[model samples]
Structures are given as structure tokens and as C-alpha cells.
Target: MATFSTRYSRLRDNVEEEPNSSAFDEIIMKQEQIIRDQDEDLELVGRSVNTLKHMSTKIGDELNEQAVMLDDLGNEMDTVDSKLNNVMKKIAKLTHMDDGKCTCSQT
Candidate 1:
């Protein structure tokens, strides 16, 4: 029992004399640098997300404007088609009256 107690006291004294090992301090410093690098990477990712959001908004606005313009163009095409149909009807009426006959008199 005395030998065991002496060995325990010697171990305790050695542990107390060297509280902070050089290897342990280096490991802690490396961990802190890693944490700082991770924080910077997260900030950059957040900025990239914001930039993408802004670009998406701009693209959506442009697409909406294009849709409106296409709608206006469709309306204009309908108007032109109606006008052409009217002109065709008038031509058909005149052709029916003529019936391949010349009604001009010699003066």
C-alpha cells in the first residue's frame, strides 16, 4: 500500500508541474484558425445567395415585360386579320355583280 501511494503522489506531482503542454497549445491554436476560416466562408456564401436573389428578381421582371409586349402584338395581329377579312368580302361582292360580263357602252 505504501508503494502504491508513493507512485500516485509522484504522478500527481509530474502532472501539476507541466500544466500546459506545447502540443496541446498548438492544437488549440489550429482549431481557432479553422473556426475563423469557416466563418469567412459562410459570409461569402451568404453574399452569393443575395446576389443570386437580386439577379433572379431582375430576370423575372424582364420576362413579365416581354409577356405584356407579346400580348399587345397578338392584339395587333387580330386587328389586321379582321381588316383583311372585310377587304376580301368587298372584293367577292364586286366579282359577283360582274359575273364575267362587261357592261361598258361604247360612246
Candidate 2:
């Protein structure tokens, strides 16, 4: 029977001299490169997400500012409309006033 150390050594030498060993090494290297590329892609995606979040916040702020401005403009228009209505009423009253008696003569 082969000794344990002899069997282990035979197995190790066989693995080292195997025809496909280089092919396995090449596959491992390719896998490692793929993982590194994926990591870089994930980092870029994270940065893009953060940038989008900041832009969304700015847009929301601008929308709120515009809403406040529109409300102020609406209030100013209401005030102007009320003043105009009052003036129209005063004009109508003046137009309804009686005119002094007038006589016309023809020769």
C-alpha cells in the first residue's frame, strides 16, 4: 500500500502538471477582472443617484417659491378688482343725478 505522504505528493504533482491548469488560471483572472469592473460601475451608479437626489430637492424648492409668488399675485389682483368695482358704482350714481331745468327758444 502507498504511504500517506507518497499519495499526497503524487496527487499534488498530478495537479501541477495537468493540461488544463493554465486554462483554469486564465478563467480565474477573467472572473477577477469582471468583478473589478462591476465594482467601478456600482460606484458610478451611486454617484449618479446622489446627484439626482440633490437636483430633485432644488426643483422642489423652486416650485414652492413659485407657488408663494403666485399666491401673492392673486391677492394683489383681488384688491385691484375691488377698487375698480367701487369706482364704477360711484360713476353710475353721478350719471343718474337730475339735470337743472333748461329752455330753448327759436326765432
The candidate maximizing TM-score is 1
Measured with C-alpha atoms, the lDDT of residue 80 in candidate 1 is 99
**Local lDDT at 61 for model 1:** 100
Q: Write the per-residue lDDT of candidate 1 for residues 1-107, one digit (tens) a residue.
A: 35543434344456656758787899999999999999999999999999999999999999999999999999999999999999999877765665675354359
Query: Which ranges in model 2 have alpha carbons more than 4 Å from their true place?
Result: 1-19, 98-107
Clashes of each: 0, 0
Please give the lDDT score for candidate 2: 0.87
Models 1 onward score TM values of 0.67, 0.67
Colliding pairs, model 1: none
Alpha carbon lDDT of residue 78, candidate 1?
A: 100
lDDT of 1: 0.87
